[model samples]
Target: MALSQLEVTGAEVYATQVGDRLTQRGHQVFYVSDTLSCPHKGQHFRLLFNKRSLPRRVWHVLYLIYLILRYKIQLVHAHSRASGWSSYVACKLTNTPMVTSVHGRQPVHRSRKKFHALGYHAVAVCENIAQQIIRDLGVPREQVSVVRNGVDSQQFSPLPAANNDKPIIQIIGRLTGPKGELVYQLLKQCIDLNTNKVQVVSGSHVDKRFAEFEDKVEFCGYSDNIRSTIAQADLIIGAGRVAMEALLCKKPVFAVGEAKALGYISLDNLPAALASNFGDVADDGKTELDIDYSNLAEQLASFGEQHQLSEQLVAAIKAEYDLDAVCQKLLETYQSAYVYTKQQEVPIIMYHRVTQDDSQKGAYGTYVTLERLEEHFQTIKRMGLSPITFSELAEIGLEHRFNHGKRYIILTFDDGYQDNFDLLLPLLKKYQFKAVIYAVTGTDHNRWDVEHPTKPDQRFELMSHQTMREIDQSGYVEIGGHTLNHPKLAELSEAEQQQEIEQNKAELESLLGRELTTFAYPYGNHNQQTKQLAKQAGYTFTVATDSGPIGMHQDLQQIRRIVMFPSTTKFGLWRKIKGNYTYKKASKQARQIDE
Candidate 1:
C-alpha cells in the first residue's frame, strides 16, 4: 500500500486497518509513504516527494520501482494522488498490478483529468467519489468499484450514553482545509457553547480565533484513544469515518463534513447521508460548502428528545461498513487485478457435443466426432497446454498455476451431452485433463433446440442424473449449472429468469451434494437482468459465447469463451486459443452490425 501522507488522515486510518486485517490473514503487506509511521506490522519505506516538482516526482517513481522489485510486491494499493502518480508509473514499468483507492473528492485539473493514476482498478470509498472520478477524471466506469470505508464494529461497539445535564457535543477531525473552516463556522455561529458542553478533538493546534471560546469549549489536542473520546460524547459532530465510527458506537451524529452539512443522521435520512458519505460529499454535484445553521441549531437544541439511535440504523451500518466484508471485497479485487496483470487472457474453450458418427452432425455445427476430439487433445498436449476447470482456475490464481511459464486453458462442455460421460471421460482420463460440463439439471435431452421444426437433427441426449453424478465424482470433470431448462434468457421474464437460474443451481447442488460455482448462459443469450440473476443465484462466473469484455477478469459474470465447432481445424483452434480471438471476433461482429 502507498499513501501520500503518513498522518492520521482518513485514508491513512483506512489503510492501517486494512493492512492489519490482511496481516492477520497471513499475507505480507508493505507500505510506501512520505514518512514512517509503521502503525501496523509491515515493512514501511519512505519516499517523500513534492507533488509539483519534476525532479522529486521522478525520484519518487524510481524509489517506488526499487521497492517493488526489492520486496517482489504482487500488488500496490495507492491512496492519494501524489503516491498514485509515482506508483502507477512504477507498476506499468515493472508489470505489477496496482489498485488505487480514491479516498475523497479529487481536484479537477487538465493533467489530473487526462491521466488519473487510478491503476488497473480504481476503488472509490463512496459512490460520490466514484462518480467524481468517472465524470471528472475520465475513468472507465467498469474499472471502478465503490468500496466504502469500513469501521471495526467490535472495537467501536455501542456504549451507554453519558448522563450529563449538558450534552457533550464533540467535533472530531483535523482542524484544516474546508473541514476546519466548517468547524470554525459551526462553533462561532451555529452551536451554543455555553448551554452545550462542546469539545474539539483535533490533531492540529487550536486556532487563535477559537481563543474566545477556549474556556467554554474543551480542546483536547490529539488523543490516541479516539474510541474513548467518542464514548464520552453525547453527540458526535463529524463525517465519513468519524460518523461511521460514531454510528457504530450507537451515538447520535451531526453529519457535518468537508463538502457540506447534512443536519443529522436518522433512519429516514440515512440513505441521503450514506449517498453523500455522511456529508463528506454533495450528491447534487455542488461544490459550495453550505451549512443550514438554523436547522443545525434546531437539531442540537432538541438533541436529547429527538436524536435517538435505532437498532435498524446500527444494523445498516454493520451491514454496509463491516471491516470483514469490506476486506473481503478488497481481497477479491486484489486477486482479480493480480490475475489480469499476470495473464491478460485465458482461453476458455467451449464445446457442446462429441459423437462417433459424422451422420449425426447437427445443423448448428456444435459437435466434433470422438476421433477429432482425440486429435484436439493430442494437439493440446503437443502444444503443452493444460486443460483446467473454472473452479481450479479461480481458486489457484493465474500466477500460481502459470508458474514456470506454463500455459493453461479452460475446457468447458456445455449442455452435458451423454457422449461427455461415455466418450469424453475416457479421453480426459487418458490425458489426465480436467473439464467443466454445464449441465441443465431439469432435462435429459436438448429439447430446446431439438424440438424446433427447423433443427430436428440437433437432437442430442443429455447426461442422466446417475451419469452426471458419476462424472462429477470422476475427479476430472466439474458439473456446472446450465439452468433448469435451456431457454433464451433475454426473452424470459425477470421472475422466470430467476426461477430458471436459482432452481437450476439448487437442483444441481442437491444432486451433486456440493456447491456449483460456475454457470453458462443457455445459447449464450442474456441481458443485464439475467446476468444479475445469475450472480444473485451465487454463481461466481457465468460464461458467454464470443460476447463479453476483452478480459475475462473484466466481468466475471459474463466471461468470453471460444466456441469450437466440427469444422474448426487444428491450426484454427490453436490460433483462437493462443491469439486475441475474442477481441477479433467481437470487432468483426461489431463491424458487420455497423455495415
Candidate 2:
C-alpha cells in the first residue's frame, strides 16, 4: 500500500508498527530505513543507506524508484528530517504520492529557492507541529493533517501499582543525543532516585558511555519487555512513543526530550499536553534539562486523588491517540493523496455585471448581456462541465475535487453589482450552478472605476447589503472579498494594503457571520507583497486577473481566471475551457474596446 522513509528513531518505530498493521489488513507493505529495528511480522524491509554518504543516498533514491516500479507502490510516506530530502526527490521523480510525517521538532530553514518539501502532503504528529509546518515550511494548513503518533493500548495496558516505600521516577528512550543527554544530566543530579528505585529501559541503540553510570542506576539495557518493565515504575519519564506508551499504561508521565518538556500528563494539562503530541513539540532549541522531582513526588503522594484523573487521561488517550483510529485516518489520507497528485486542471470563468439590455455592454468589458450569460450556462451544461463556487473548490481542494477527469468550472462575479442579484440569480438557479460574488465592502457602486470618456454613462449600481445577505444565505452562492475600497494594491503602501485586504475580510466575516476565505484582487492588479498580505489576512485562496487554467500545481494566491466579455463567443468559451484559447495574446484587442 505504501513505503516509509525511516532511521533508528521513534519515527521508524511508528512506521514499522503502521506497516505491520497494514500487512495484517491484507495490504502489501514495504519499509525503507537505516536499520531493521524490530521488524514487524509479514513485512519487507530495505536499507536506506548511511545518512551522510552522498553516493548511497543517490543509490537509495534509485532503489526507491525501482521499488515503486517493481511493486507498483501507490504511495510513499517519509518520516523524520533526514529522509525527507531523498524521499521528496524520489517521489517527485517517480510521480508517486508522498506523505511526510513530522514526528518531532524540525528546525527547517526558510529558503527562497523552490521548496521541494511543499509538494508532499504533511502529517504533523500534533496540532502545534502542524501549525509550525504551516508557518515555517510555508505549506498550506489544508495540505497538512494532524495525525498524532499512536500507541498499542492493549500491549502497553496498565497493571496494578507495585508497593513501594518511596516514589520512583524513571526516564525511557534510546541512550543518545536529545533523550540520552537530558536523561544523563537528570540521572547525575537526582542521586536520591537510586534510594527511590529508578529504572532506565535503554533501547537497543545505546551509547557505550552509559555504562559509567550503570552502578548508580538500575540499567535495563535493550529490553524487549518494555511494557512490563514500564508497568513496574511508580512514575514514568520519557518522550515521543515512550511518553505515549507511559500514558496508555496509566502512569504519571513527565515528557522530556529534545523538544519542550510537558511537566506532567494530567487531566488538567491533558489538552495542552496532547496539542504538543505529549511533549514532542518544537522549541527555539533552548529548553534545557529542567526536572521537577518535588512536583512529581507531590503528585505521586496523593495516589487516590489521581485515580479519577488517571481514568480521564486513559480515556483521552484512547479517544485521540489510539493506533487503530489514527491509522484509519491515515489510510484516508493515503487514498486522497494519490488522487490529489494526479488531478487535472479546471477553468475558472470570471464575470462582473449581467444585464438584460446590450446598451451597457460596450461601456465596459464588465457587462455581459443576459442572453449571452444564459448562452454561456447552456454551453457549459452541454459540455458536461459542473459549475462550482470558489469556496467549494477551496474546501475540497482543487486536486481532490477535480482529480477524476471531472469537467468542473468555477463561475465568479466581481464588484458586487446590483444586476448580479436581479438578472444573474435566476439564471444560476435555472442552471442549478454555484457561483462566487466578490463584494467590495460598504460600496453601492463601481465607484473605483473612473468613467471612460468615449463610453456612454453606465450607472453601475452595486447590490445592497440586504440583497448580498439574501444571496449569501442561499445554498448556491459564496460571498468572497474584493476589498473594502477597490484600489490598485501594487500602487498602495503595505499598511494601506493591509487595510484593504484585512479590513475587507474582517468586515465581510462580521456581516456574514461566516468565514470569508476567498479573495479577488481589484482590477486583477497585485504584486508579491499583495499576495503575502492576502495570505497573512487569512484568505485560503485568492484569484488574480491573469488568464489561465487553475490546476492542482497552481498557488492558492494568484489563482488564474478567464474573464469573459460580451464579445466572447460560445466557441471561444469552449476553447478557453479546453486550455486552447490564448487570452493573453488577445487581451490587447479586448482592452482597446473596453478601455
Candidate 3:
C-alpha cells in the first residue's frame, strides 16, 4: 500500500493495526493519519460516530481514493461503520473486494446506515450476531460471513498450580463512562464477606474515577502484564480486549454490558437483570437488575474449576475471527469490486443563466447574446451534432454507445432569468434548438418579475420559477423544480432535501397536464442524500452548474451543459462550437495589437 491509502480510514491505529497485521503475513500496508485521539486502554483510535464534526470524517476521503487504485491487495477490511463505508466506496471505485469486522457497535447510527451495511462483505463475531445482522441489519446474506474472535492460547494459558493466590477479580475498561463505576459497584456487590477474598485491578483508569476508587480498590491504572493480570485473577469481569485476555488467562468472567451488549443486544430479552441500558429504561423492568446479589454470591461458590472459562471460550478462537482470515476474505471482495469499476467516461457539464451578459461579471462565464448563439447553433448543425435533451443523449449514446456516429449536446440554463425570454428565445426559434432551464423557484413567488436588459417572459417560455407553488399551469414553460430554498444541498435534512424535489414535481405535475421529470440541484451542490432524493422524487434527469458535456456515469441529478449568455460575441461563439471552449485560447484574455 502507498501513503495515499490514507484516504480510506485515516485512523492511525486502525491503519497501523491493519498495516501490522498485513505485514506479519508478508503483505505491505500503507498508513496515514490526520490527528491524534484519546487513548482507549492502549489502543488509540478516532471515533467514527461524531455526527456534528465532518472535517474529521472528511479527512478519510483521500484514503478512499488510494484504495481505488488497483493495487495487488487481496482484500480490504475495516473496523468501524464510517471507515467501513469509506472503504467500501473507495474499494468499489477500484473494483476491489472489501469487508468489515463489526467492531462492537456504531456510536451514532443514522437511517442511511442501512445503505452502508448493505454494501459490504459482513463478518460478525459469531453466528448469533451473523443471524441478527441479517435479520435486523440490512447486510446481505450472500456477502456476510461469521468469524469469531480469537485468543492467544500459548501466552495466555491458565496460571500454574504452584502459585497460590487469593481470588483476584479483574475488570478492565477505559476508566471512562458509566461502565467504570458499574464495574466497581458490581464487584463491591458480588464479592461476599462470607465466601471469597476479593482483589481488583483495572487496565485503564479514568484519572477522575481513580480519585474516587483510590480508597475502595487497588489503582493499577494500566498494565503491561494484562495476561498475567488475568491469569492471577480467580474471576474476571468487564468486556473488550481485557475481557478477552482474561478468558485466555483461564479466568471465569461475568462478560456483559460492554459495546456489543449495551447497544445491540435487546434488553427486554435479558433475564430481568441485564437489559436496562440500551438507551434508557424507565418502566421497563427487564433492563435493570431485579435479582438478589446475595443469591448470586452463593452461585459463584460452585462457579466450576479454575480456567473453566478458558475451556468454554474455545469456540470463540476456533471460529476463525483472527485478523489473518478476515483480511483474506476482505481481499477477495476488493479484487472483484475493483475489477468492476467502469471507465470514467461520462462528462457531466453544468450551466447557469442564458443571455448575452454575465449576471455576476467576471465570475461566471460570459453570456452569449442571440446573435452569437445563432452562430454557435449553426456550427453544431453543420457538425451533425444532435441537440438532444439530457436523458436522450445519455440513452442514445451512453447506453451501449448506440449513437457512436452521432455527436450530441444538451442545452441547459440555470437561474431562470428574463433575457432567456426576449434575447435567447428568438435565437432558439431561428435555430430550432431545444433546451432545459433550471429556474430559480422562489424569486417573486417563482415568477420572472425582475426587469433587466429585457422584460421578463418576452422571448422564452417561462418555466415554473415558483418556490412555493407548482409551475405546469404557466402553459408555455416546462416545469422543473429548483429547490425550496437555494441553499447548498449538502447542508439540509434528507427529509427537507427530498421535500424540495417532491414539492416541485408534485405541484408542477398537478398543475400541468403532464408529469414533471426534470430536477435542478439547488446551488449546484449535492451530496449522496440529494442524489437519492432526486431518484425518489422520480426525476428523469437533474442538472447542475458544473462544466462538462452531458453523459451517463454522472448520476441523474448531475447531468452536464453549457450556459448560454447575451454578451457572447458571434466570432467567439464559433470557436466554442469547434471545442475551443475546452482550449486555453478561449480561456486567455487576449489583446490584439493594431498594425
Candidate 4:
C-alpha cells in the first residue's frame, strides 16, 4: 500500500516509480491519495478530506483501515504527514507494518514532536532531512534510513542538445509556496528575459507580476513526459529531484530550491549541494529563503561557461540514484518494518570451535567442549525451538516464519574447524537440527590467529574442501564464507577487503556447488566500507558481534549475534535466548563503558 497527500510532487514521483517497479516484480500495489495523478500501474483509491477537520481526520483513519483490511495490505508507505498520521492509526489497528518517507524538512512543533507518526520506519530523501527528523521531530535515529529519490536512468538518459542562438533556460517546479515566489523573484530581478529564452514548467498559474515579460517567458504547463521537456532545454534551473533529473540528462543545472540557491552545480560545490539537497535546505535548518537574486543571476551566467560535467560525475550520479538499487534498499526497509511489527526476536547463537579435551582450550575462550555442545543441543530440543540456517531464513522471510507461532533459533559455527566436520556434524544429524559453518576457504589452519605475536598459539586445522562439500551436501549443515585469511576487516583497505570477502564466497560456492548466503566477519570487526564490501560480495546475511549499531534483525548486513563462550552454561543459553535484545542492549552499553 502507498499513500500520498499531494497530487503531483517529488513524493508522488517516488511512489509511482517504486509502485511500478514493485508491480513488475510480481507484487500487487495500491495507491491512496487525494488525486489520482500518480501513473503507477496499481489500483487507486480516493482520499479527499480537509486535513484540519476533526471528523474528517477520524473518517480518514477509518477509511484507511477499511482499505487495509479489504486488500490485506502487508505494508503501508505514507509519503506525507497528512497521510502519515491517519495511516499510522490504521496500520496499528490492522496490525500491519508502515513506512513513512520524509521528503523535505518537517515543521517543528510540540504536538508533532510528541506524535511524530514516523511509523515503524522513516525514510528520508537525503541526509539533511534524516538528521532534521531525528533532531527536531524526535524520531529515533535507528528507525530512520537515508534513501534518496530514485530516478529511472534509462528513461531520463542524456539527449543531444540542439544548437540555438539563445540558450533556453527551463525552470521546473510547482508554481506555489517558495518555489513560485522564487520564480517570480528570478523573473523580476535576476533573469535577462530578452537575452535568454526563458520557459516555466509548472502546474500552477503564473504569477501576475510576470505579465511584464509575457512574450519573453514561455509557460509549458504540467508535462506528463518531463524527460521530453527536459531534453528540449539547453540549461535547467531547479532543485532536489529536478536538479538530479537534469544532471542525469547531462544538462547543466542552476540549483535554486525552496530554501536557498546553489548558483550552479559543479564538482567544487557538489558536496555542499548534495548535503543540502541541491539547496532545498539551509545550513541552519530554517525555512526562510536565502537566495540573493542579483548575485545568483551573475553566478548562473558565468557558471554555464565555467562548468562542464565530467563523465565520472554523471556515472556517480547514476550509480547513487539508480532506481533498482533504491528499490532494493526500500524493500529491505519494508522487511525491517515488518519484522519490527511482528515483535518477535530470533536469537542467533555464534560458535567458533568445538574441543573434546581441556588441553585443546585456547586463551580466547572461543570454543566449547563436544559434550557441552551436545548438552546445548539437548536444551534446544527440550525447549522445542527449531534450529534453522541463514539460507532457510532468507528463503522464508522472518514475518512468514514467525507468523506460524513456532519458536525458531539460528545456530552458527564460525571459522569452519575440522572438528566441526569430525564431531559437530554427527551431533547435528542426531538432533535433526540445521546449522551454518562459515569457512575461511584460503587456508586450512588458524594462521591469522596463530601467527599473532601476543596471542596464544592455539593452532587448529580448518575443514578441507572435500570435508566441507560432504557436510554441505548433508541436510543438516549449510556452508558460509568467513573471509580468506581472517584478517580484521576494518583494518584492511577496500581492495583487500573485497578480495578477501568475494574470493572466499566464490571459492566456497564453487566447492559446494551452490551459492552461499551467509558470511561471518572475521574477528567480528567491521566498518561501513567492509559491510558494503560484504554486500557487494553477494552475501545475503552478514554476522557481527553484539556491538552492531542496529538491532539484530534490523540490518541484514550487520546482524548481531550471541557469542557462546566456553563458560556459557545451559541456564545462560536459555537466558540469552529468552531476553536476547535485552541482553544485547546491556552488553552494548557495557562495552561502551569499557571503551
Candidate 5:
C-alpha cells in the first residue's frame, strides 16, 4: 500500500491490517509511506517524503518508478489522495495499474480532471464516499467500488458479560468537528454524576477543549493499540472506524459524528447504520440528533449494569465485515484494476453536418456551426488526440495489430450531408485528419422529412453519390453505409433490415470503387437482430449513438459514440474528449429520438 502520511488514521490502519494479513498468507507485501506501519513480520519498506514540496513529490514519483522496476510491483493500492495523485502519475509513467481507497471525501478541484484519464479504479471506504467520487470527482460509477472498512473481529472480540459493573463511556478518534463538540458536552454532562462512572478519551489531534476538563476525563492521548483501549470501555461514543472497532469489542456504542447521530447500535437499524458508514453520514443526509444528557447517561448506566451484547449483531459483523472477507475483496479489486488499466479507452465523437447557420432548426442538434467544428478540431488537437477512421479502430481492436502510441477518437459524420463535403472537408484537410462519413446510398434527400409528421417541410438534402465518391477519393475520408433510406432498423422486418443494410453497403462500395467494411445504424437505432444482420451483411464493425467512451473489448457491432451538439463549446468539447461530460440527460433524450 502506498500511503502519503504514516499517521495512525483509519486508512493507515486499514493498510496496516491488509498488509499484515497478506504477508501472513505468504504474499510479498511492500509498504511505501512517510513512516512504516507494518504490525507483523518484517517486510520491504520504502520512504516517501511529504507531498507539499514539489521536488519531494517528484522524487516520490521517481521512487515509485524505481520500485516498480526493482520489485516488479504488480499492482499499487493508494490509501490517501496525496499518495494516490503521485502514485497515479508514477503508475502511468511506468504503465503500472493502480487502485485507490478513498477513506474520506477528498476535495474535488478542477485540476484533478486531468487525472481522470488514468481511470484509477477506486475502492471508496463507504457508500457515501463512493457516491461522492462518482458525482463530485466525475468518476464513472462502473469504475468505483464500495468496500467499507472492516474490523479484525479476532483482535477486538468482546469480553465476557460479567465485567459490566460501573459505566465506563469512552470517546475515540480525532477530537474535532461536531463529534468532538458532542463528546465534550457529553463529558461535561457526566462530570458531576455520582454513579461511580469512568470516562476515557483516546485519540490523536486532541483539541484545546480538553484543557478545561483536565481533571475530569482520563485522556489517553494517542495509542497504536486502540483495540486494547476500546476493550477497556463499557460503552463508546464515536463514529466511523472507531465505532466499528468498538462494536467489534462488544461494547454498546452511540454512533455520533460530525453533527449526526444514530443514538445506539441495535439489530433493527444495523443495515441503515452500515449504509450510512457507521454514522459518519454525508452532510446532506445527516440524521438530526438531540442528545438528552441525563437520559443518555441513564441508558449507558443501564447497559453497563444489565445489557449484554447481541449475539446476532456480532454474527452479522463477522459475516459481512470480517477482515478476511475484506482482504479477499481488495485482492479482487486489484486484479480488476490491472485489467482495466490495460484496456485502451477510445472516446468516439459523432458529428453530423457542419453548416454556416441553424436556419433549419428541425435537426439543429445534428448541425454544428462551422465555427464550432473548428473549435472541436482545435480542442481535439490540444488534447493530444489524433482522429482515426472506423477502419483504423477495427484494425486495432479486432486484429490487435497496429499500435498507435497516442490517444485516438473516431470522428464520424453520420447522415452524410452535402454540407459535410463543402464545410467539413476543409476542416479535416486543415487538421490533416481522417474521418468516416456514413452516407445513405439510395436517396439524395432525407425523404423521411417530407413524409414524417414531426418535420413535414424540412427536407434536408443528403450527399449525392457523386459527392460521396469525391469525398472517399480524398484519402482523408472513408465512406461507410448508413442504410438505403435511413429507416429505423429495429422497426423493420429481418428481410427489410437486411435489405436496408446489405443493399446500402453494396451501393456505397459500387460508388466508391472499394469494398465497404464499416457501417453505422441509421438514426442510431438497432437491436440484436439489427446487429446480427449487419454482421451477416459483411461489415466488419458498426457504431451506435450511445454516449460514452469506447474500450478495446467493447462490442464491434454496437460501438458507443458521443454526439457533438451545436451548443458544444471549447470547454464542453474538452469534457467530451475527457469522457467526463455530464450528458446523461441528453443521452436519454437522444436515445428517445431516432437520431
Candidate 6:
C-alpha cells in the first residue's frame, strides 16, 4: 500500500502483547513495564530487558529471569523452542504454565525433545501445524492449540482485478525476522530460477532490523495502497501479515512460515483466506530446491480469473475471520480476564466551536452566548456528565481506563481559525471545559487571495499543518502532522509514502520537543498504506472529516465525526447522531445528511 499519511482506525496493531490478551480472557493479568517504544508498527514492545552494551541475545536471557522473578510470572508464551526451554525451566521453578506458540519457524529453535521436557503447550497458526505438534513433536493432543491468524476483512479486500498478462507477484513483510528471512530465500529462488519476467513488489520495514535484505531484492518498504498491490498481483507468496492481506483480496496465495522448510507453509492449510490455493510448484529433479519455474509460469497463467476468483474467495474468507467473529473471540478473552467488564457507557459527544455570544454565527458549528456558556457550566456543577480532554479519550481508546457509567463529552473544532481563542476562550474559561481544536495549520486557511477570505475561518486558533513540516512551538497549541504533501496517501509510492508519514514526525519532534499524539486525515481519506504509516508514525488517533459522531466504541482509527451545517437544527443533530443517515444513501446522493 502507498500510504503517504496515516489514518485513524483499529487499522494499526501496536504493542498490545500477550498479557493484554490474557486480560481479555478475563484473567487477573498483571502488566510490568519500565520502558516504552514507538507505536507505529504492528507489534508494540517494551524493554522486557535492556542492557546497554550487551549483545541482545545474552541480555535477553538475563532479563527473562529478572522479569520472571520480579513479576512472579505465572505463564510464559514463547515463539521458539529455545525461548520455550528458558521459559519452561523458569515456569517449572515458578509452577507456571508455559503455553508457547510456534509462530512458524525452526532454524534457531531447540529440538522437539527439549521442548517436550519444558512442560510447554504449543499453539500453531493452522491445524496442519497443530497436528505436527501432536504427531511430530510428541505433544499430547490436548496440549496443542490452533488459531489461524486473522485479518480485518473490512479493511483489506481485492478490487475488481484487471486481466493483464504482466503478472505481478505481491509479497509484504519485514526485511528481517521470519518475514525477512522468508523473502530473502524466496526472492533468491525466483532469481536463480530466472523468473525476472514476473514483477515482484515487496512491502516492509527496512530499518536496522532488516537492512541487510536491501542488497538482495527490489524492496518496496512501505505503502498505503496495499490492497491495490494485491489486486495487481497474479499471485501472492508471503507469510504473517501479507498472507492475511492476500486472502482478503481473494487472491490465490502461497505461503511459507515453517522454518523447517524455509517457512514454506501452504496456503490451503491456512484459514479460508483464499478462494482456492495455488499449490506450490514442485521442483524438477534437476533443481536443488523442491520447486519448478516452468510450472510456476504455467500457474501464473491463471491471472485472468481475477474478478471470478475474488468473488468466490470473499465468502470463504469472510466465513473464517470476519471482524464480528474476531472481536467476539477477543471479547471472550477480555471477559475472561475480568468477567464483569461491560459495554462502556460513556457517550462521547463532540462540539466544534463555542462563542461567548449567542448570536454570532458560522456554518456547521454552534455559537453560544455568555449566558448559555454559564448555563452549561451551572449544569456541570449540578453534574449529570463531565467533560474530558483529548488525552483522556486516547487513554480510553488504548483501553487503559474504562469508563464505567459516567456521561462525558469531548470538544473538538475543525479549521483552527483565530475565533477559537476570540469567541470560544471566554466561554471555555467560564465553564472550565477543555476543548481541542483540530487545526489546519497550513496556508489552506490563510491563503486567501484577499479573496473568499471569510468563507472558512471561524473563532479559533492555528497550529502547524504545512504538510507536516517542523512543528512551531508557540506553546499555545498542540501540533500534529497532516502529511508532508497532503495528497491522498494511498496514491504515493512505498518509499515516498513512508517519508511523508515518518519525516513529519521527525520534523515535529525536533521542533516541539515532544511526540505528536493526534492526526487528522487531510480529507478524511485513507487506505491500507495510510493506516500502516500512521501506526509507524505513532499517532494515537487519526480523525476524519467525512464520518459521523465518533462513539466511544469506534476503533481508534476509523473514528467517525459529524459536522453540522449552518442550516442544521437540533432535531436533525440527534437523528444524525443516532446513525439514521444511511451510508448507502450518502454514497448514492454524493452527500452526507447533516441531520
Q: Which candidate is the best by TM-score?
A: 1
Give the candidate number with the greatest lDDT. Answer: 1
Q: lDDT per residue, candidate 1, 35-143, as tens digits?
A: 6443678888777843549898888888888888887787899998888999999999998899999888888889888888878899988888888888877889999
Candidate 6 Cα lDDT to native: 0.47
418-505 in candidate 2: lDDT tens per residue?
A: 8888888888889999999999985677666645355554568888888888899878789999998788999999999989988888
User: What is the Å distance of residue 71 in model 1 from its true position?
Assistant: 4.4
lDDT, candidate 6, 491-573, per-residue tens: 77877767867776676567556777766665576776777778777887766655532232335555555555444444544
Distance from true location, Cα of 382 in model 3, Å = 40
lDDT of each: 0.84, 0.72, 0.48, 0.82, 0.73, 0.47
Q: Using TM-score as the measure, what is the rank order of every candidate, best first?
A: 1, 4, 2, 5, 3, 6
Would you list the rank order by lDDT, best first? 1, 4, 5, 2, 3, 6
lDDT of 6 at 114: 48
Judging by lDDT, tell me the better candidate of 2 and 3: 2
Question: Which segments of model 6 are wrong by more than 4 Å?
Answer: 1-62, 68-75, 105-111, 117-120, 157-167, 173-218, 222-234, 252-289, 305-307, 310-312, 322-595
Summing lDDT over every window of 10 consecutive residues in candidate 3, give the lowest-scoring window. 1-10
Cα displacement (Å) at residue 103, model 5: 1.0
Worst lDDT 10-window in candidate 2: 579-588
Alpha-carbon lDDT of model 1:
0.84
Per-residue lDDT of 1-595 in model 4, one digit per residue for the tens?
A: 4455544688888898988997876567898888767477988888863364889889999999998888778888998888888899889888888999888999999999999888899998888888888888888888888898889999888877647678788999887888888888888888888778999997777677768778889988788888888887888889888998889888888888887888777777888777778888766778799777889778766744755667777787788789999988887787667655754367788998888966788767778999899989988988889999988887766434444346889999999999998889989989999998989988889888788888757789998889889999999999889999999989988999999999988888888888888899987899999989888888888988775633455567888788898888998888777634644564569788999
TM-score of 6: 0.40
Query: With candidate 4 superimposed using the best TM-score fit, by how many Å does residue 50's alpha carbon deviate from the native?
Result: 4.8
